[model samples]
Target: MNDLIPLISSSINDTLASLSHFYAEIILAAGFLLVILADLFLSRRFTQLCFLISLSTLLLLGVQSVILLNTKTVFLFGGMLKLDHTSILFKLLFCFSSLLFAIFIRYNSPLQKHVKGTGDLFAILLATLLGMNLLAMSMNLLMVYISIEMVSLGSYLMVSYISADKAQTESAMKYALFGAVCSAIMLYGISLLYGFTGTLNFNDPAFINALKNVSGLSSGVAISLVFIGVAFKLSIAPLHFWAPDVYEGAPTPVTAFLSTAPKIAGFAILIGLLPVFQSEGGQTNTQYFDFNVILAVLATASMLIGNFTAIWQNNVKRMLAYSSIGHTGFMLMALFAFQGSGFQALIFYMAVYIVMNMAAFLIVDEIEEQTGILLIDEYKGMGKSNAMLMTTFVIVLVSLTGLPPTVGFTAKFLVFSSAFEAYRNTDSAVILIMIITAAISTLVSLFYYFKIPLNAFLRNSQIQVMAPGNSPKAYLGLLLAILLLVLIVFPSVIVKLI
Candidate 1:
């Protein structure tokens, strides 16, 4: 009993020390509650009050992230979390995405016109952003599970929150049900790992060595279960059926957020969990399955499935949904190939991906508002009426295609070059197969991505189209598109920042 006193004192001390590094998250927590209160009382008088507070909170959080970029790494909450450069960068990206989400909510015609107020969405987004920040920093299996459930729960609510039609209600139910199954699988896996290692702190050397002592098949299955759960959240193949239906059915702004921020958080979790599986002392790590080989296969399969299926998609959002799955696979390839500069390339691609994806959805929302074009067939010659907007859309598609003079090109180039470097370093056939698959997937994606421009410009439309109204979302999307172009010209800007 006496020994417990010293341990308690040390635990308290570490937590207190961690608080200084936690100010940004503190502000976020405070703002989340503050928004709920503001919505309850002030929303009647000032409709946008909650929105304003959410933005301010995200703004404060973003500033804190930038300032903490150079801080030395440290464990928080008794090693449940780890504050590091990578986590800080991910936080900054998340804050930026939430800001865009808020702006999108403000200007989105469908959301704005809905009977349900946008105030609650602002609050939910703040809460979800907080979860993402924690997920990015989580170093323990316990924290990882908690943060993931938090984010998943928030997403489930968001998708169902403004259910206006049967499709939305159906999508919501599917997302929640599917997510619940994955979460259970993951929890069982965690239980197995804890039973094997007797510690939830994945960073602890004990976790690694204990797994090493475990039977090969046992450790392999346990870890693979955990991987499947995380992959499900990222909408990777064989677990990705829900994404397209949800994206097509959910509000456009919600669809955009779903595709970008949550996937990034999933990558962070995968990155942290990866080091635990790698073998030490230059020995064969056969205690676990061939982790990299499986990852490469998943990447190759995802790229092919996502791209090839996207070619047949009619709904614009559904097409992007499949494309996102392909992108997830491509990014996973980067994760598999991560060595030295490969990490940097992955980060750069993610940063660029956020911009291009958000811009695409925003522009689509604008076109939907004015022309009500939901299908690829609907875009026929509408570019003739909305030339500038369609031109912006074309440029965004160019970037998404990783063509020259767009930041998307730069992002893809870095990833491919780094992937080749990984291949040269290891001479692994798995990496070679994925590299080929990625190249082919990119070409396949062109057919779907260009379908927008081709139908918008080359095909003729008989129906008259009006120009989009003065929309804040459209302008913001345009700014993002231009930023992509600017970043390509100075590729080092975002690359070095990351």
Candidate 2:
């Protein structure tokens, strides 16, 4: 009994030590609390207080993350959490995304016209950021479940906040209900995994080693079941039914944030989990499951479905949503090819994706604000009157289509090349399929992405147009678009970092 007491005390001390490594996340949580309080008491007096607080909080968090970049450390609160480079990268991305989101909300939230409590929106965003950061570090299945639900709940609230129409409300309702069901299923999967392995840490080397020893069917069910929640977050094909509707119905900025940040987090979690499936005694351990083939098939399906479905979307935001899914497929391809240098390529693609999507949505919101139009056809003759904005929009769309001399093209090339390398090394049929499918989908994407330029430049409209409003924020967004344009030519700027 005395020996057990000392062991218990030692475990407690180790846990506390690990918690210190996550000081950045702790600070973020505190910021979230402070934002809520300031929103309630200080927002009325200081118009921009909530925004300032949120932005400052994320900025500081970003700094904190950068400080820990080269450190490799993991701490488990009794085997529930793990922190390391992977989690740090995820948190950094979340911080950058949150900052962009705040800028987006300030400039053009769809709810701005009708909503009174944007302060709540910022707070929810912070809360979601907190969850995603935790998700990157989660090793336990229960921790994974909790972190995912936390982010999902925050996302639903953000979507429903100050919704202007029945459609938006309906979208939020669908999201909440669907997300709840997915969470419940994932919880069950976690329970099964815990029961099978008697441990919850997916990243714990020993835990995963134990899990692999389980019955073949049990391991497959456990892994596939856990992937359900991630697939939902990623908007992958089978679980992607909610994406277009949610993206179309949510405010444009929210749509942009939703499409990018959470997807990146999900990918990080996937990266953390994939190596665990590389069972010992060769890759043919189980007849019913081949992890690589499953991911490859999902990638193929996501690319095909996302690109083809996008071809049918007239609403700009909806098209971007499907496009985001297609991008997810591309990222999955990277996931397949992931090794030492793959991290660089993945970060490069995600950064460029965020810039492109944010800029595209900003333009959507700007056009809507000026012309009160949301359809692609409504963009007719916009090129002539809104020449500057349309020019910026064309650049962004071209990048999205992955044309030459664009950052998107560079990102795709790296991913494709890496996959090709993986194929050469292994000659895996699955890798070949993924590469070919992704290439074809890129071509398919070109058809719809070009529609933006076609409508703006070639099509004509009878309606007269007015000058764009004098908003500096719009110019800033255009400047951001220009930055992406520059990134295409100067890809090394971001590529060298990761």
Candidate 3:
């Protein structure tokens, strides 16, 4: 009992020291509580009151994050998490996405009119943003599991916030159940790893040494089990079953957030795991399990499956959901060169992706709100009355397809260049194959993405269209679309950050 006192005292000291480095996350925690309190106590008097608070919280959180970015790389919370440039970048992205979602909810009449009120939705957003921020910084296996579960729980609530229909309720249930299974599998893997290594700190040198001492087959099995949860969040194939239905059933803003922020946070974990995958230490027998090959195979399968499946989707949200899976595969290619410019490429790509998704979903929601159109075919001849929105939509789609004049193309090019550099340095056949597959998938995507422009302009309308000219949401979407083109012209804006 006397000896335990020393350990407890040391833990307290460590926590105290860590708090100075944890201002952004502290703000996130406080923001979450304030939002809930405001919703409970003050929402009845002022309906949009919670919305104002949420947006201000997000804005303040973003400023706090920028201030923290200068902090040197240091482990916090007794080494449960790390403060680093990459993690800060991921946090900024999360905040930006959540900010966009707040405005999206503001513009969404159906959600604003919901019986359950939208205040709770903002609370969930804050909670989920907190989880994602933690996810980006987690350095310990235990922290990783807790953060993932945190995000998953908030996401479940966001999906069923309205529950205006059976589909939304069912989507929420499916997400919860599937998430539970993935969490269990990942926990089992974490247990096996802890048993083998006797350490939960993955960044600890001893952890890799221990894995190196273990049999190759055991190590591979444990690693695969843990990555299943990550794959689920990134919407990689096989683990991608929940995405299409969930995205389709979710509010458009929620869909945009799911497809971008959490997925980018998932990649942050992958970035942290880079050392374990490198084959530099011959003693570690890192070559025995080729994550490059495993990831390449997964990337290929995701690309083909996502693109082909998207081609058959009539609903815009479901199609974007599937294409997001494909984009996950494409972004997975960036990790092949994780130590090089790949991290830069990944961050840039993620930023551009957030913009592209916000634009796409904004346009889709506007069309639906104005005309009750959810199908791609139903978009016919919209360009005539809604020229500005349609032009923005076309630009967004073109960017999504990785074509010229949009930042999406620049993002894809950066990733490709980074992957190519890795291949040139290592001469890995898997890298070459992944690149080829990514190119093919991009071409395949064009067929589906172009369907928007084709139906909107080239094809004539068969049904009467409601007036679809004026909308604040459409203007916001246009700004995002134009941002894509501007960034492409000045690619250095993102590149310099890298």
Candidate 4:
């Protein structure tokens, strides 16, 4: 009896311990189940039940995150997952952006009228956010692979969610095929890594220590191969072939979500992976510098391609798609500058990026809702009429172009400073080139970014459409944009927390 009592107490304590560390995910997962059930039952009676469920869940998760504010602990079945400051920061961002995304979908999307599976869309988004939260905290290869697939599958489905048109269906098909191929390649790479290192845990001291014995070429290949999966998520240059078509075809809200949240989470995973794979002693046993060189080259290519090609784009969403690729290059700069203190920079940059991109897309959807127009040229002369929308758009675009008095500028400055610090410390030639190229690209971006306002306020067109609507959603986005500017002035609030 005495032995059994001790056993019972220990078991109960262990269960409580596990549950406590997972509060944020617990809130999100519970919300997911509630959303699924709500869609099953209430969606027939109330049109907004699923959206409300998703929003409620996100709100609960945010509250849970605040509750667990400073507690950093690893939880789950074993040492396979972690919830630290870094992971918590990303999770908070994911939840916050998801909240905004839900609003965007609710207000501007044609999904409510056109799509049959919106309930499914919300459920899938919840599940994908779960995957992203896990991806941020994963300490094992198995979790990494699972989380990646979860996000990929969710993305593929979202791309196809409104497949009522040929272009939409074709975009979905391309995204599906491309995503599957990348996952397969990534799986093979993970297998190679597991075989070489004989362990699946990324955070285990033993696993990293064992990696030292592996051949440099083998390690580099394995590491780069693993990043292929992540690169697919971020849509950096080489892996970016599908971005434009998919962005143009998908529901604009999904495009907005895809362009921001999951990509940032993917970069978080890359940061987690890179430190373990860094070669010691500068011995250079491997020919490739793994992700650093690959990402540097990709950033340079992305900057050139994303900028020059965007200059030719007439469609607003498609233009933003390429612009997102360009932003990927800037984010990569943060990755390169990732020495100590760079992690904070990366997190802050991601937060600002989310706010900036979501706000930009919100405006896109708002304009589309009011005027039924989608082209940059269609925006001509509206800057004079849609004063509020255009002013917000201009502020957001200026941030994207990395100008002052916006969070975008601060984020860019943070990353550039980190890169400069890296160069100062190491004098690496690659760092030098990345800095110069990023500086030049920042200038090039102003040309295309200004085109929207230039056409709206400066250029002439017969695009005399109805005035923009007085939407609560648009105002909400504007409020968030204002908060972003506030953060830009006082970045330390977020930076200190990160």
Highest-scoring model, TM-score: 1
Put down candidate 3 lDDT per residue, 1-498, tens digits, no spaces.
887987997899999999998888788778778878888899899888889988888999899887777668999988899988888889989998999989999988899888888888988888888889889899899889999999989988898888888888998899889988998998998898888889999899999888778877788788888888888888898899899999999888888888988888788777776665442246645566767688889988898899989999999999999999999998888887878888888889989999999899999999889888999988898888678888999999999999998889889999999989989988988789889988899999999999989999998886758664667888899999989999988988766655
Query: In model 4, how large is the Cα lDDT of residue 288?
Result: 44
What is the C-alpha lDDT profile of model 1 across 299-358, one tens digit per residue? Answer: 888999999999999999999999999999988877756757778988998888899999
Judged by whole-model lDDT over C-alpha atoms, candidate 3 comes out at 0.87
Candidate 4, 349-412: lDDT as tens digits: 8888888889988888888887877998788888777888888888889888989888888888
> Which candidate do you rate higher for TM-score, 1 or 3?
1
Q: How does candidate 2 fare on TM-score? A: 0.95
lDDT values for all models: 0.88, 0.82, 0.87, 0.82
Shift of residue 371 alpha carbon in model 1, Å = 2.0
Q: How far is candidate 3 from the true structure (C-alpha RMSD, Å)?
A: 1.6
> On a 0 to 100 scale, what is the lDDT of residue 351 in model 4?
85
Residue pairs clashing in model 2 are: none
What lDDT is reached at residue 257 by model 3? 80
| Candidate 2 Cα outliers beyond 4 Å, as residue runs | 1-4, 76-79, 277-285
Off by over 4 Å in 4: 1-16, 115-117, 279-284, 287-291
lDDT of 2 at 351: 85
